[model samples]
Target: MEAYFIGLSFVLAAILYPLFIRMLKIKNIGQYIREEGPDLHNYKTGTPTAGGILFILISVLFGVILKVPLVFLLSLSLFGLIGFMDDVASIYKKDALGLKAWQKFLLQIIFAFGLVSLESTKPIFGVEVSRTLYNIFWIFVIVGASNAVNLTDGLDGLAGWVFITAILPFGFLKQDIFAIIVAAAVLSFLLYNTRPASIFMGDTGSLALGAFLATFAMHYNAEDALVFTSTIFIVETLSVIIQVSSFKLFNKRLFKMSPIHHHFELLGWKEEKIVGIFAGINLLIALTFIVYKMW
Candidate 1:
């Protein structure tokens, strides 16, 4: 069943790729490069946006068919919709920035609350955790994961590969259903999202992917392992946080550029090479966690 879903997701994504391209052109929906970002990214302007919808759709289709869980489907779709709105706003405003921080946070909180409410009514996997704590944890998972993926989207295919690699630990724990579906979806997205991407996942796909992984972690009681599993995201987000803090606090710079990847780019590393290095590190971390769990 898992293999079938994987293959099915790949095929479905392949079929949808050209259609998405047409839709993007029809709607004139594309990305805007931030002036503050690396000059290398200037060329990426006007590339298709909202490609993450295809990824999310593929995963939801398979997940629903497999009867994974209502909460999973609801949470994934709800978050995806929020991301979709943000993507739309970016394109409409012709700005690289999408939703305001407060706006996005409010929407995320609503979705997280909805998931918590659902989980409270029918606890997933029979795991016992207090409702209030669970709600708080869910908020962190949803918001943290969303932003992590958003930060990791610095290089082409970097976020996709990192997400795919992170899902492996969950698979190893036999908590494979949600992770498998997510892996399949990301694999499908990678068909176009690879180096020289045909389309960017934008906020729409990244946030959805992040939220789904967070939900999976919560479901499996593997939230503890998420730290190691999501090491790449943590590192990426930390780089930005540290950079911002240092600049504001001391007028000092941490990295030549934030998010760590741009620092590598400024150091003469090609985008593809940086992505490969990060993805490899993410894979190693995930594998290490899986091996430790087995022992």
Candidate 2:
């Protein structure tokens, strides 16, 4: 029965992306690539943004059909709203910068704090902790994961495939029923989101995947193990932090570009090769986590 939803979502995503592309184009809702990004990506500017809406809608539809808990679906919708607003603002501004960093940060923190207060989220990897500390840590995971994915979205097929590698193993290993369902939908969306992507996932897709993956790991009481599962995201995020600090403190750029993927690209690695390598690294992390759990 669960597998049925997964298969259905995969088919739905495959059907929905092309249709969404046409609709978004008609509506003039498209992505605005950042000026600071690589010259190679300028061509992608104005591609249909909010392609994340495809998977988010699919997830909700399937969640209803599958009778997933209402609270979880609502929570997912809330996070998606935050991303949607950011996407909308960026389009209106005609630039990739949308929702000042502090604004996004505050919203994520509020959402994470509210989520952790839920009865089901009380347990953190089966360990008891003070509520204040737990809120801080959970906020870190939610915000960090969301932004990590946002940063990794610099290249075609990068964030989507990396998320698949990071997410599916834990879902299957832990028998997380909804994770499997969402994964199927995301996989189907990837049909159009790969190289020469017809549509960009934008912040909408990035935040949905990020918040969902972060919460999904917590849903299974495996937050501790998620560090291993999401190593690539963490590394990408850290590269940004390191670069920023270096520039601030010593006036030296740490990498040719931040997020590390851009650094590799600047070094002349093909986009396909970089995505493949990162996907490999993510697979290694997921496999290690699975083996650790089994052992």
User: Per-candidate TM vs. native?
Assistant: 0.93, 0.95
Among these predicted structures, which one has the highest TM-score? 2
- Which clashing pairs does model 1 show? none
Per-residue CA lDDT of candidate 2, range 1-295, in tens?
A: 7788888889888987888899999999988888888888889887888888888898888888878765457556767888888999999999899899899889988887776666353667677887777777777887788888888888888998888888888787877677788878888877888878888888888886888777776656678767887888889999999999999999999899988999999999999999999999999988987987888
Could you give candidate 1's per-residue lDDT for residues 111-215 as a string of tens digits?
888776766432434566677767877788778898889889878899899988887666767666666766876787788888798899988888887887787
- Candidate 1: Cα lDDT at 285: 86
Show model 1 residue runs off by greater than 4 Å: 120-130
Give residue 27's lDDT in candidate 2 (0 to 100). Answer: 97
Error of 1 at 223 (Å): 1.1
Residue 168, candidate 1: alpha-carbon lDDT: 66
Candidate 2 TM-score versus the reference: 0.95
